[model samples]
Target: MQRYRMALALLGLAWAAGMAHAASEMPVPSALVGAWTLERVDNVYPDGRRVELYGPHPQGLWIIDAQGRYMMQMVRAQRSGFAAGDKSKGTPEEYRAASLDSNAHFGRISADDHTMHTHIEQASFPNWNGKDGNSAYTLKGDELSYVVAKPSSGASEGAHGEVVWRRLP
Candidate 1:
């Protein structure tokens, strides 16, 4: 009886160790886990015109964790300040400018060799909350690029947007 009890105990420890090892392995590939900064954000029209979606010299950060989660934010570098100096007191124009100048979202992410899938839990744009999206992506060395079929801002009706990022050291 005692021998059987010892065998069960040993089995439990081995099982626990296996679980811990699996947990330490990332759900996504190691190359995708890191801090990345925006390099460019542009919309390309069918007519071959390229528009800077976040304005020239846009600023942003994206962080992807080993657990298959990510958060991203981007903003126009030359956004106008609120004249009222208080968010609650902002005029309609100020509010509109604010809304059009930035994008932010947080969510879970998974990826295949060529596509990144996202499930946005929440976003600064309320319409995107609870949305699921997929985009084809390419990762080369420290750079990553992806396309959004229908971007939220700064695109003509039929235009698609490209976003590029550089992994941070």
Candidate 2:
């Protein structure tokens, strides 16, 4: 009788521990629900040298709702102008066209919160115009690290970089 009760108590404790472990492993989508800003960008050059690129402190906001709807908005600092590859300049018509072309280049967090995908459009060189590339992200707490790869067109081959972001207050 005493032995039987001890066995049952151990079984119950084991079951509770299993439940706790499972709960900890379960991915919570709400954990990533907030605004984030680009803190720093670490670029890996082809020569195996890593370079850090600092932007004009671009601020980005990411919102994830319970309905699985997500939206992000990023704006560069006013004092810091756009990069050479930025397609948001020129005449009004040109800007409109560029914005439309680059609209799909935004980033979105996966439903599992394990992956983040970002798209970027490149139209700088005439030969490489209308080219888009994607980057994959791995998140750790409030930090997100991404690896970006350029498309293969012989124009800008093997161009890759990693960017890290932190959740804003």
Point to the candidate with the largest TM-score: 1
lDDT tens string, model 2, 57-93?
6444555544334454443333323445455455666
lDDT of 1 by residue, 19-51 (tens): 966643326777889999999999888888898
What TM-score would candidate 1 get against the native?
Answer: 0.81
Q: TM-scores, in order shown?
A: 0.81, 0.45
* Reference-based lDDT, each prediction: 0.88, 0.50
- Candidate 1: C-alpha lDDT: 0.88
Model 1 / residue 92 / CA error / Å: 1.2
Number of the predicted model whose lDDT against the real structure is largest: 1
lDDT of 2 at 85: 49
Error of 2 at 123 (Å): 13
Model 2: lDDT equals 0.50
* Off by more than 4 A, model 2: 1-28, 49-58, 73-108, 117-136, 151-155
